[model samples]
Target: MQNRITEQPSNYRDLEKKTIEELTKLINTEDKSVAPAVEKVLPRINALIEVIVAKITNGGRLFYVGAGSSGRLSVLDVIELPTTYGVAPDLFQVILAGGVDRLVEAREEMEDDKNEAWEKLEANGISKKDIVVGISASGTTPFVLAALARCRKENIDTGCIVSNPDSPIAAQAVYPVEVITGPEFITGSTRMKCATAHKMIFDMISTTTMVRLGRIIDNQMVNVKLINHKITDRATKMLMRLGNINDYDTAKELLFQNGSVQNALKSLNPDNYPA
Candidate 1:
């Protein structure tokens, strides 16, 4: 029951009275603190990522459980992994409060329903092989907390990203990441700075995990799915560069034949591909 820093008053007051420039400047100033707060928790984030990579490597999935803005952001992150890294659609999933189908409705009240998250997770056949990470700016959301609690009872590993210290959600997590982004520009409106930090952390976790799983080669998304003209063109160019082919048409042909830059490169030099 300690004070939640995210719920504290904003550092800048009288927002309604401030000029447009003044408001933007003040908000930007507060925004500068979010990165350092995340930086302070790098070690904790790394620990969670390590576990995620190991579990996922051994036929496990990563589930992000959250509500409100956190849940929406997680959805955005999970949906991109497949096209970005050529991973399976189900490899990374989300268990959003109110359900992802109703995400556009912004059903904030559903966050208080503690039973829903566990039911959804159970329906997904959650087991010890999967890792679930909770996302809640307050670190006290009933929906996320309950799911993690059930996960613990079932011996499924859990992790969390919260903006408060010593929160109940963190206590339930085996690998807790407390970023402590502090009060928002608008008092208790965690959708601002807290959401920003969560987005950054999501980028870190997914990008790093994909890299560790050998989805990248020399900083290129070699495993990226060529599902569009733009991406196909990009992958074709990447193949030309990596395969040392001077002709774009030839590389494009190779890319289409193999279906991916990684595969095209493998066809060119099988020894270059990772084991």
Candidate 2:
């Protein structure tokens, strides 16, 4: 067993004696270290992202398997990709320990089941083409570790995000990112800095993957779905700017007709816009 720094005693003691303001300030100070911890592992993160991009480009999907806060945070990230990047919802998926349907229930006990994660992955028709990334702040969550071990046995590519060094979960991953955020402000409560690191890393993974896959055009979400009036209006303006159209109504009309900024731009006539 590895020394789990996340479970070590916090640097700050006498928490009960601290004032509300003092508590908040101390927590905020600890939060400041999370970004730097994640930064230290960028090379490992880059390696994982490269594999993810290649697999996705080759028609494979990305699967995030996690438990507790790590799992819930992944759900938030995966759900936004479709509307934000205009990609299929199935392109990114999450397999939470207690089933995503029961996510709000906070079934922390489910993380102890060693076989459930692999069973869920198998039911999804998991294959070698698809990549599975485990999220476990403790680096020893049985649900996540079991899944990664099985994935390796089945010849599937695996990666992991953990806060402890030489963790069993990291050992199973071909590409492991150990952010090592150290002890949480609340001792073993990984939902603090560890969760923050996981959330930030998820943002980096999804956003960078989308950009590399060309879902973003010049830093703009040109492929974004016009799901609501606000999004539609935004896409309309984007089309107007990118298509170089002079009239808002005309741009909105073309945007509606084509369904998105990317498509509307494609429908524009080369000679219709001023040079």
All candidates: TM-score: 0.98, 0.96
Which stretches of candidate 2 lie above 4 Å from their native place?
A: 269-275
User: CA lDDT of each candidate?
Assistant: 0.93, 0.92
Off by over 4 Å in 1: none
Which candidate tops TM-score? 1
Worst 10 residues of 2 by lDDT: 266-275
The best candidate by lDDT is 1
Give model 1's TM-score versus the native structure.
Answer: 0.98
True-structure RMSD, every candidate: 0.9, 2.6
Q: Candidate 1 at residue 48, lDDT?
A: 100
